[model samples]
Target: MSQQQDLNLFVDNSIIPQKVYRDEPLFGVITHTQGTSPSWLINLLIENALYGTCVINHEKNQHRQLRSNVVVISFLNDFDFYEKDLKRNGIEVNDNQQFHFIDLFTDLFQKINTPESIVKIFDQLSKTIQNIPNKKTILIEGIEFLLSSTGITSIQLLNQINKLNKIADALFIITGADKELIDIQHANPSLPEFKTLDFIIRLLHRSNIVLGLRPLETGRAKDITGTLTISKGTIPFDSLVVSEKEYLFFVSRETTKLFFR
Candidate 1:
């Protein structure tokens, strides 16, 4: 398929925010998270906010040393990945602080698709997100969960994105993509989704600081869990490192190393 076709697909999916957030009926805090990268996104955001750096191995650093307003919003399944580091790094959040997650089908059906529950759910979730302090940076993460052919995660994700975008200057870290995206032909399909050049491009267009992970033949690629795709820009489970500047164009493998800095 042509790049325009690919871009069209992405724009079709993501267009709601680009327009809705621009004006009209605004809802609560909105953010996206993938089955992958919850750990890295949370840690990177916290580390950057606190130490102005990235933490490759937490055990090597002084736990008590971090001091910053860091909030990690994660889904139920992936919460454990960052739980230990969060406590060690002095960031704490109650269950209420985390955004409630659902898939796109449910979001459309129960929330948007249906007339009754959608607004109610949005109101409740929005209130929950709104209560969080605006000045503090929040790491929003949630699982899109596996959906059947009939199921959808888009509505729920859009809700989260809508909610979060309301807060000015909030460093929103969003992850996740349509599982079927890989079936599409991306220019550089060799790279992982999270690390793909297009993924970085789309991410940097939306976010201020983007760090995507791509696996290498060696190094930390072995244990890291996730699939990376350039065309789709979503991963099954893998690691990647992406930066804001590199997102707009072809990024060399060596350039990804800069994220460690």
Candidate 2:
């Protein structure tokens, strides 16, 4: 399929309102468990970059973008991994001037415990934003990993996000947690170290848009099922209520559709 067609299939356009990006910074949370796959979210991020939306990728380079406008920052992985993945994803990486990869792991990891180092990283991020053109969307992946690895608190991350929102027109974040563990914690209500759940809840409280993806409960092999919960946002279709509402969705490689059922 063409790239445009692939982009359309990656997301359900009916669930997103027109010009929603204009009103507020778009924040998205995508959750999945250990066994489930989050490739759909990765595809969505790539689509955004391919569509000429500036992307600041931080997902550790599981995928690649062909567009020169996409900039990737590799934290946990090496630059070669990103180059290989980009090629695997059909994105050419032949000394492309537009496509850039910044290796942050070496410098940041050496001084991860120092407050000065953290501040330096944040300063670098700010500088990068300043250079980007105005009114562009920034996609951030692996937020959870960043926090856990760097020992950054939720408040600190939120503050960084707020800063990014001030500079960028829109922002989308992708984070994942184990669904089964969350369920076990929910049922027990006494499990310790619900850190993932706590982080997810805190982020959700601050997010304008939220999406959850998991495998089908019925064990169906054809499609994945999840819930798309919207709160304090507008959607394109009138069928979606403006207020907080949860809609069940089926996602396959071919398409993504939302419904009440």
Candidate 3:
């Protein structure tokens, strides 16, 4: 928005509310349209949690007084890709001791084919963070990918997520809200698309905050890429304070810029 607003940027990153997440656990959900990418936003969050500050995020001047250990379970991108992006934002994912990336994208073959397989995955994922001594912030990208790939049901997946959620100081789930995924015209509970839509809806209901992204409603503009909307969730914590806000953002090869919408 403005230089003055940058002084108070996201609660200290004011769009992100770093203060509210300092002590208690935080659960956030982000949904993106098909053409809009949430990767840059996710990278910014990782930077905020790991470094406790923002360098080239939406606003470079924002600050995080509390740093957290970050664990990311990504189903859409590989380590190499994320590593490259984060490096631009000052995170050395490979060398950092507190940053962990679980590459479910490249290693999706570890699918849950049976009930025992599901347990193995649940235990493995949990143990990964249980060993970490610091306060943990876990981010899951494309968790819905698990639905189509594994035999695990939506209820079962949500249960595992809830248990994992309890382990972290902050948890963020990123999913696609593209209409194709959520369309219910010929709803089939058996399909993973419908299953994923249901899963995302439940998450939205429980999440304290939701950061949503979508393509420009009007025709494309050279300077703007998409819009980011932050809204309080259905069951947000009474203590969690956030106002519904929107921003026009542009992500370029080297940096991201934001403008009041």
Against the true structure, what is each candidate's TM-score? 0.44, 0.60, 0.88
Arrange candidates, best lDDT first: 3, 2, 1
Greater-TM-score candidate between 1 and 3: 3
TM-score of 3: 0.88
| CA lDDT of each prediction against the hidden true structure | 0.36, 0.50, 0.77
Against the true structure, candidate 2 reaches a TM-score of 0.60
Model 3 C-alpha lDDT per residue in residues 1-261, reported as the tens digit of each score:
353122112332343455545665678999998778999889878877776666654446655344678899888898899999988886677878888888777656656456467667878899878988868889999878777767777788899888789788888999888777777776777787788888998898888888889989996878889888887777756455666678788888998777777
Which residue pairs collide, candidate 2? 17-236, 33-179
- Evaluated against the true structure, the overall lDDT of model 1 is 0.36
Error of 1 at 48 (Å): 4.0
Candidate 3 global Cα RMSD: 2.9
